[model samples]
Target chain A: MESRNFKRVYVWELPVRIFHWINALCILVLAITGFIIADPVAILSNAEASESYWFGTVRFIHFATAYVFFFNMLLRIYWAFAGNKYASWKAFLPFSKKRWNNILHVLRIDILLQNEKVHDIRNISVGHNMVASLSYIALFVLALVQVFTGFALYADNSDWFLPDLFAWVVPLLGGDFAVRKVHHIATWFFIFFTIVHVYLVFYHDWLEGRGEVSSMFGGYKFIREDRLKKTPGNTKEKSEQPSESKPEDNPKEDEIIV
Target chain B: MATKTDTRETYYESIIKQGYSRRDFMKFATYIAAYMGVETSMIGQVVKSLETTYRVPVIWEHFQECTCCSESFIRSDHPIVSDIILNKISLDYTLTLMAASGHQAEAAKHETMEKYHGDYILCVEGSVPMANDGYCCIAGRSARELLLESAKGAKAIIAWGSCASNGCVQAAYPNPTEATPIHKIIKDKPIIRVPGCPPIGEVMAGIIVHMITFDRLPELDGLGRPKAFYAKRVHDSCYRRPYYDAGLFAESFDDENAKEGYCLYKVGCRGPMTYNACGTIRWNNGVSFPIQSGHGCIGCSEEDFWDNGPFYERLTSLGGFGIESSADTIGKVAAGVLAGGIAAHAIAANVSKRKELKDRNSRGRDNEKQLDD
Candidate 1:
């Protein structure tokens, strides 16, 4: 049996871990609340629920979760500057000539769908590779936009704080009705992306055994001894562990035979 | 109060000069008080007020709008709303109603402003166009200039309809003339905005009555609309609220549901979100509002309401089993299984309110007990 005790690198910080889990919860709550508000599915026809209105309750949940999502976003943005190299802006963009080639190669594959195994782990950093980084950025943008349009919709009859900030967008898309329609449609995008995102997380976790899911909450992960220590082509990752001994330049290619 | 008394005497003397009888004046007083939403007991006060106070000078300006406000004012629900508000009070000048033409009409308006200075009401109907130096001009004076000059001397400005309030439909997208609302231009003067495609005649009269009787503006909402008249959403007092709650919305205007007087939201009614007195004060001498006339509320009273959306197509967020997610949704259903949902909602609301009250009382008692201890 493989010994449970192994060298574990502390990759994700505590704030990052908390941010990940809280964001997941907030997304789930927001999604459920959003769909419920959009289309209230009645399970029992005869039963009348009167104490709290469905719209009111769903709206309360949506708004509360939105606050969580908003705070998570703010902290995440802050962490980009304050975090380690792996968790910072350098991790998010394709910079090197090798990665530029990979981006083009990946773009080709993205258009012509391929299995996830075909992608090279050695060619990229750990947290999020170039493609995944941009995808994360897209999601971040979507989340930020969602907060804006969400607040605008909420501000339709309420406080001016959100409305004043985003009032210009209401007129940009024709008028209030169009703005409302765009907001309603954007909600569906977030929902669809979230479904795919959760599925991918579980699939990758089950396949790679990299402990990706657990790392988000626990802030550590176990890497194989044979795998490249300095993120393969991405040598910038060397700063993380100052004391770990360098692997032999050419260790014999050994397959694990438990 | 003295200003009111003086205005009242002035009105009595004006009518008396015009050879109107005391009985006619008293009859007009009762009619005006009732239409103004004053109780029958207040008729004596209205009579005393009108009998004692003079008619207020009014300079009515017309711009990029139909003079429906003046039409509605003249055909008001109150007999005096027309007589006292328009011809009888002898409004100093209005473009549409005034018999004088060209220089005479201009001279009369100028005379009212120059004489009354700060006492006359400036009733503006329609939007002020702000293209060129204002291409929309009246008697060689740009509508903007005329509005400013008239407003400069006025005590209060009453934006009579949606046109004056939010530029109405004229200020919608691609507005070539740059129609602007009255308050947007006049920062110094106090304005009371009465927005509606054409406001309910009685409501228009009521606002005037409140101003005249109270000798001040009526209590206003955040939107600068009179609270007594514009407080409740059209949905709140709508006759079809029961139908809406019962989930019996009219699928289409020609459907059986429509015939049975169901909620018209599915067919483009903005009633659920729009606040106005149409559902209560009604229109056409208390006979009916638009909803009663088999038309969905157009939300003509709200800001940018003209551009909000098509009148039909139910709001995505508003419909469905509204109570399904409430505190007692499931609990109340169980309560109904034991009794009935009707009883459950009532009992649950009662129990919840009771608990709330009890908790509040307990907290208060705890504070008192703490002091005693």
Candidate 2:
């Protein structure tokens, strides 16, 4: 494999990178603020209880933060339609008959037990394949439900404004306590999925010489030169892409930069 | 419905002879409506029901009960319950109150049953024992046979107190007599239950007023008790509810908290689960019920009041929507999970960054030598 050189290709766009980081930061703020509203810490000893005016201030902050978070989610929802093939739901969902089997195998063997062989990037598919795709969809659904239930509870006391649209969710949930329990339980799932995701992103960079870490943020990765197109950026050095005549070929790569 | 004796004429004459005016009748009507928990506007309807209809020829039955129901009923402050119920309503026979006894009392009961069969109301005041071929007998007739025979042509059957509504103290666990209420013995007639250790006097009166006014039984709960009396749990309307919500309770009967009017929940108050009008209609001229008399509720009106356990012990514990699961407990569980997640992120992020740096540095060193060549 010493002679094998992988040529680079640009796969991601700038809007996609900016949207990903902004949405992540918003979710972090929302989660922290939500917990604080649920149980306000008495930072000062003589402070008033939840019925006091200050508690209302805390809820306002929580709602305002939710507005910004939901706004970013809406933008991401639209981007899925306008973005490139890899960013679309059709691309992310494992739909092909052959690719679908590989996804299921990886989910059971790797996700259940963290199978090291399955961790290899070559074993991962071009699209989301399985685990990654399901994580994003589940997180998205939970975030929407959180907003719906939150508004239902708030509307019970307040007048018809922002909460009117979601007020019907309250009756279906039975009461405020039911909505509260669901929201509290969903936060734990979001936390668990975030932890495993960061681990896999870095693991691929070390053993595979794949720019899996940078391809997400910087939008490009190097492919094997013998098997794929030669990069125009590296045109000064010729013969990176091998002739079809030589079936098995290898070339060295100088830099494995993102 | 001739009422056989034209008792209304003789009844009015006696009430007049007793020196009561007609204005007293109107006042009795108003008082009965309020007691019935009927809306105030329905007072006129009550007056018409009692005045137009012939006094129901009632043949009162007694079996295993202590006769406390009649004692409580006759003392009803709403003079009409006692007046109309006893002297005016044509209560032709009751063993405890009849001036005549033995064969004469038995003759009076049979006379009313024969003359007004299929028309008169039959009010039973006790449970009928069903064990050992009905060993519980009266006048050489078994109580079971007496109840069935009396109820056969009755227009409606009213079980007066807990003994007749439920089995009461006699029906406690390992009940030997197998004392059963009217509903269990008779299957056809419309039955209305008024249950209590001895039901509130007003509740007894209210049940009759509803029957007389509507010409039907009052709306009943699943247990056959009039909904007006048993619809709400005693806890729902208790004056001690604020104390329960504030988590202040009397720890024991002799504790200092007991004197302060704190919730009696810790001291075996069954008020939380028991349903009755004790807090409102109360007993004997709206004076007080057991809980108001420095004793906790025995849940006397509830089914199986005797077997519910020692009256002095608090209920097992309050069970409901997270009233006990404090806000602090929920917060700690959430914080524990959050802290663990953040720590995991910090460790994983550091590992990922270092691994990425080392790989990039190794590639940079190899490229530097190749450039020199």
Candidate 3:
């Protein structure tokens, strides 16, 4: 292996890293408990009804985790405004032309399996790639739906003010039955997302040698020195093409370091 | 030839003429007070209303529907209820019960509407079909026209059954006749909806008794259903509810669990979603309800229940993808296909990485030779 110069780039901030893992754990708990709530398996027990509150306990765990998930999402939204550039809400939205181009480039090489030109210096993203950021945006919207529907359903059985506020959602969507169906189907969406998200993170770790998987744990990524040298000062534009870089075909430039 | 029955007779005279003893009348009042969720002390008020009030006239209208509401009402558990409510209080009009037909019936309805204007109760038993200029007509007048005319003079309206409350099966998807519920068409009036497929006979009787005793509409829920009956879900009061909480469900109708009277949620019970008095006020004179008879609540009391999906399956079938595709089926298939794709892609990615490595090693060797030269 050839020796290569590397620079440690501060990508995910502390709050962002915390949010990611906690959110992942919340998603896992929520999906499992939610599925059970939808179609509970028979738990054979001769114990008295009050003594055997396993299903009730499962529901309680689900609701508790849901509260954590909801508030954590809200905290992340607040951090999007107060945290570092990579953690900014602006990173998730594809409003600018350059962000749109980055999204297309990711779709071409990573998703479409195309033989695209490798501009390693320009392609090395210090934070989330355009596809990832956009997906986070979508997932955030789905999370909001879960919160709204989950609380609305809870309102029927609870007296809490927060759940009561959304009580109108049940009738607005037709009935409690319809609301429960929507909530169940949305759980599957999260499950599908988790499977693909974990797979793609490992895939990127191997393909780019960028510590993509570990970066969320430590808030830093090993980026190539040449890529770091080419980085522009305007941080939000990190996903787009660098202002100074010109295309080069030197194979040595592909040498990645951690 | 109609001899105007003297308005002088009280409901006591009518019940006595129908062979109901004082004991039977008081017992009926107590039963009604219980069904209405009123205090035991309210039974005296109910009896007093029966004795004093000049039996409030009712104008019952039928539209695009089967006459199941009337059938359910007339089959009240006690003979006195059928005699008192149907034969006595419902004097002015009801298509099925009224002996007078044609002009005689129409004249009676008009006369009642005139005489008891702003005092009579309007009981609507079916949905009004609004397509093609009010298609469901009776006595040469559209149901919409009759509803508007009668409702204008009515003190309060009682929408009987799911048909009048929510348009029932007629208002199911792609409703050809444009059948709409009474409340939607008659917007200005305060309408109380008793929304069962054919609301329980005792529940129907209880509503009338409460109205007669209190001289006002009963407290209504968000959907305008009487809170006395619609406040709690059947699941809340179900005998098999403990099984649900314990996660013990009957997998199929004939399974041992089902025979043991386990929760019917697995057998497509709509109990969790249906709010009615079925569990608390058992049908057929408190003898048994559908669940007691080993069947699930069909969610007949809810709005657009026909469109909610299969009667025997949990979860609604997604609309526009044909009628057979449920959410679980679609979700499982989608997850399965995606999993397969992920596996295939993982293999492809690994193979490509190996090829890239081989090509890179060869390029490195070539570079070393160039340095040697």
Candidate 4:
């Protein structure tokens, strides 16, 4: 085993991390309560109907969490402009030629499993890869859809101006039933996205030996010194690059640390 | 030809002429005002309007319908309402109810169109079939021609039932006849849609009385339904709503839950999505609505409700997919495929990584051996 130099780079900002965790929690709560609301379990009690507000409580939680989810997304959108370069909106949207090229590279190496070797360190992303960033963009759009449909359904019972503004969404989609169907199906998409996202995060963490999982929490990712130097514009914190030049004397110790 | 009288009879005079006393007319006024959701303070105003205003001329047209709206209107609980509104109070032409038929009915309709030109209310009880150059015809003229001709001089239009308000059964999927609602045909006029399969008789009466009292269309919702009647969903006002909130749904029609008056949401009730006054006004003179009689609401009044069914199944079915599959079914199948694909990808990733590692280890050993030599 050879010794290697590692540099820790700040990736996800504090607002981004907070947004990610809160958004994840909100989706989990929304999906569970949403499914239950769609097909409720019959809970029979000898107690009077007035005494049992179990379904109402479930709906209340769903509605309240939905507001949190909506506002959290708004905060994230604002941070995309205000946050650091790695957390910028430019990274998510595939407008530039470099981003499109990176997307293809990711598709070949990571998704398709075409090659295990990265021929160039410059192709490695310190922040989100093109594919992950693209998927996050898609997720943002889906979240908007869920919000619109959710609030539109809420409009029927509510007199508040905010929910009422979405009343046109009902007739536009044909009816209340259609809106409910779209909202329900979009939930399954979140489930699918979560499964693939968690799996890929673990895969990348194991494959690259980068602090992928912990980076989300502490907002720092460990990059090899050689790769960090090769990655253009990512070497802004040159003073922070030469922190640890630890020797890989034992592979077992490296495994335990990772 | 019918004589065009300059002096039109007031609703009070018409009701009085129909062998009803002033007291009966007042009772009828109060009954209609309550049903119309008019404020108690406005009851006197309603009485005053009925006394002063001349009876509004009505031209009732039937097209691709079964005449159920007419049947419902005649069977209103208040005999004076049906008797005066349908028979005496200047209902110039109705194919189902008018005694004058053939040329006599046609002449009477023409007379009202000429005399009351822009003052007559056109009540359409059926959908107009647009396919095959208007397949549904009346008196040797196509329904479209008759509708357009009658609608041209009307003060306002009233779409009486689901047949006229929505396309109803005739406009369901693969509608060969291409039946269309009145609102789609006449865009200029203020069309108030009172849309039940056969709207509650009292509701029909109440709308008419509202028009007479207010001398204009009642306040309407986005769907052009009277806000007073169609403001809340049937589920919202339903007596079984507490059961639904409590999650005590009837599993089957024959279950003990059914006997205990549980909510019928599981057995395909459309009350949650359907907006109507069925829960409050009820049918058969407020005797019992469908829910009270232990049958789930079929959502007959909503648009494309005929296509949105198998009336006995819950709303989980996705009709746009061409096949009748529930959202859960499609979602489960997709999830299964995704999970299987992920498992396969993970195995491939691990195998490729292991091979890469072995190659790297051998290459490192070879380089060390070369250095030693």
- Each prediction's RMSD over C-alphas, in Å, is 17.2, 12.2, 6.1, 6.3
DockQ of 1: 0.02
True contacts kept of each: 0.01, 0.00, 0.40, 0.46
- Residue B160, candidate 2: C-alpha displacement in angstroms: 1.2
| Between candidates 2 and 4, the TM-score winner | 4
Off by over 4 Å in 1: A1-186, A192-209, A213-258, B1-54, B88-90, B132-135, B213-216, B219-222, B315-373
* Clashing pairs in model 3, backbone N/Cα/C closer than 3 A: none
**Candidate 3 residue-wise lDDT, B86-116, digit = tens:** 8888568989888999999999999989877
**Runs in model 2 lying further than 4 Å from the true structure:** A1-258, B1-14, B317-373
- Report residue A120 deviation for candidate 1 (angstroms): 10
Provide per-model DockQ scores.
Answer: 0.02, 0.05, 0.36, 0.35
| Candidate 2 C-alpha lDDT tens digits along B1-373 | 4454564654344455556777887787788788788888898888776656666678889989999999998898866568767876678888888788889888888888888888888999899888864557788888888888889879999998989988888887678989888898898999988888798888887787687678788998556778788766676677766555444556666766666666676566777556688888777798877766767887887676675555665422112424344334554566677667656755654454555446556776777667855
Model 2 residue B347 CA deviation (Å) reads 29
**Tens digit per residue, CA lDDT, model 3, A1-258:** 454555566678889889998999999999989878777885445665656767778889999999899899989999999986678887777775666777887777677655445545565556777898878888988898899999988877887788888877877886777788889889888988887888889878876666898889877676665654343463442332222233353233322110
lDDT per residue (tens digit) for residues A1-258 in model 4: 463456777767889999999999999999999988888876557888888888888999999999899999989889988887677777677776666888898898889888735466556677788899889988988998999999988998787898888888877886676777789889999998999999999988867667899999998887777643244555665333222123342222111111
Q: Model 4 lDDT vs. the true structure?
A: 0.83
Worst window of 10 by summed lDDT in candidate 1 chain A: A249-258
Candidate 4: segments with Cα more than 4 A from true spot: A1-3, A116-118, A227-258, B1-6, B320-324, B355-373
Each prediction's whole-model lDDT (CA): 0.67, 0.68, 0.80, 0.83
How do the candidates score on chain B by TM-score? 0.79, 0.80, 0.88, 0.92
Per lDDT, the best of the predicted structures is: 4
